[model samples]
Target: MIKIKIISSKETYSVRQPVLRAGKPIESCLFDGDDLETTKHFGLYFDENLVGVVSVFENKSNNFHDEYQMQIRGMAVLEEYQKKGLGNFLINQTEEYAKFQNASLLWFNARETAVAFYEKLNYTIIGSAFEIQNIGIHYVMYKHL
Candidate 1:
C-alpha cells in the first residue's frame, strides 16, 4: 500500500534525497539551497519508505501581472517504484493541491520520455521540445484546473 503526505522541514532532506538520486546533476530547483523560499514539497510513501517526491511552485510574473498558475517540478519515482502508478498518484495529488491554491493551471517542463505519461493525465504540450543539461529533452505541458 501507499500513502501520500505534506512534508515538514524535518523530513525535507529524506524526501528530497530520492529525487536528487533520480535526477542526479540536474537536481530540480526544489533541491536548491533556497528551495523552501519558492516551492511547496510533497512525498509519497510505500509502507513507511519514501518512494517518490514532487515540488510545486507559483509561476513568476511581471509586477503588474495578476495571472495565477502553479508549476510542478522535481517529480521522480524511485527506480524500484516505477511503473506502479505512483507517478500518476503524485500528479493527481499535486493537481488537487493546485486547485486548492486556486491556481488556474498546472504546468511543468516534462521530460520527453514522460510526454505520454502526462498526456495520459490530460496535460497538453504548448510548444517544441527543448533540452536541459543532465535532464534530457523537455516540453512545456499544462492542464487547466
Candidate 2:
C-alpha cells in the first residue's frame, strides 16, 4: 500500500537530491521558503519506505492575479517508482491541500520534459519556456483551483 503524509522540508531532501538535483550540489536541494510555516512538504511511502516527494509554498507569482496562490517546487519520485502513477497521486494530494488554504490557483516551473504530464492534469502553460541557471528549459504552468 502507498501512504501520503505531511513531512518536514528536511525529510524531502533525501529524495530531492537523487531525483531532482542529481550531480548538482547538495545546496540545490534547499529551496527558498522551504521552512516557512506556510510551506508544506509531502512524502509518499510505498509499504514502509518513502519513495516520492513534493513541496508546496504559499507563494504567488506577479504574473498571476489570483487572490491566493501556491507554487509547487521539487516534485519527484524515485526513478524505480516512475511510470507507476505515483506523481499524479502526489500532485493531486498537494492540490487538495492547497484548496484547504483557500488558494485560488496553483503554479509551478515545470521542466520541458514534464510538460505533457502537467497538461494531462489540466495545467496550462503561461508563456514560453525559459532557462533556470543550472536547470534546463522550464515553462510556467498553472491550474485554477
Candidate 3:
C-alpha cells in the first residue's frame, strides 16, 4: 500500500535521490537559500521507499495577492512509480500544506508536458508559456483551494 506523509529528516535522502535522478535539478528550485529554512515539503512513500515528493513555499512577493497564494515546486514521481496515483497523493499533500498556511490559492511553474496533469487536478493556466533556463516551456498554473 502507498502512504503519504510529511517529509522528515530521515526520509529526505529517499526523496532527494529520486528527484535528482529525474534530471530536473530539483535542488535549485527547492533550496533557494532562505526558503530552505522556511518552506514546508512533503513526500509519498510506498512501503518505506519514497516514490514521490512536492515542496511548498510562500510566494516571495510583496504584492497584495502573495499572502493568498503558495508556490509549489520540485514535484516528481519516480519512473517506475508513475501512473500509480502517487502524483495525486503528493499534490493533495501540497494543497493541504498550503491550506494550513492559510493560503487560498496554489500556483506552480508547471512544465508544458505536465500542464495536462495539473489541469486534471483543477489547476488552470493563467498566461502564455514561458521558458526557464535549461527548463523547457512552462506555464503558470493556479488552483483555488
Candidate 4:
C-alpha cells in the first residue's frame, strides 16, 4: 500500500540523503528550516517503507507578490521509485496542504532535470537559470494557487 502523510524532519533525512544530497555528507540533508515551527515535512510510504519526501517552508521570495507563499525544498524520491507517479502524488498532496494553510503561491528552485516534471504540474519558470554550487543548473519556478 502507498501512503502520503506529514512526517517529522528526521524522517525525511533517510530519503533526502540518498536522493537529494547524494554523495554529499549526511549533514547536507539537514535543510536550514527543517525544524522550524512553520515548516512541514511530508513523506511517501510504500508498504510501510519510506520512499519519498518533500519539505515546505513558509518562505517568501521577492520575485512574487503573494502575501502568503510557501517554498518547496528537498523534494526527492529514491531512484528506484522514480517515474512511478510517486512524485506526482507527493507534490499534489503537498499542494493541497499548502492551500489549506492559505498559501496563495508555491515556489522552488528546480534542478534542470526536474523542470519538465514540475512543468507538467503547471509550475512555470520565473527567471533565468542559475547554478547552485554542487547542484548544477536550476530555475526558479512558481505556481499561483
- List where candidate 3 sits over 4 angstroms from the true fold: 8-30, 33-35, 60-66
Q: TM per model? A: 0.81, 0.97, 0.81, 0.98
TM-score of 3: 0.81
lDDT of 1 at 8: 50
lDDT (Cα) of model 2: 0.94
Best by lDDT: 4
- Model 3 over residues 1-145: C-alpha lDDT tens digits? 7887777433444565564334555454344632455577677889878888777777743322655778887788877888877899889888877888789888888899898899899999887899987667888888878
Q: Sort every candidate by lDDT, greatest first.
A: 4, 2, 1, 3
Q: Which stretches of candidate 4 lie over 4 Å from their true place?
A: none
Residue 74, candidate 2: C-alpha displacement in angstroms? 0.8
How would the candidate models be sorted by TM-score, starting from the highest?
4, 2, 3, 1
Candidate 3, residue 134: the lDDT equals 64
Local distance difference test, candidate 4 = 0.95
lDDT of 1 by residue, 34-121 (tens): 2566567788999989888887888742321337988787777877888899999999999999888898888888888889989999
Q: Candidate 1's C-alpha lDDT? A: 0.75
Q: Supply every candidate's count of residue pairs whose N, Cα or C atoms clash at under 3 angstroms.
A: 0, 0, 0, 0
Q: Candidate 1 has which clashing residue pairs, if any?
A: none
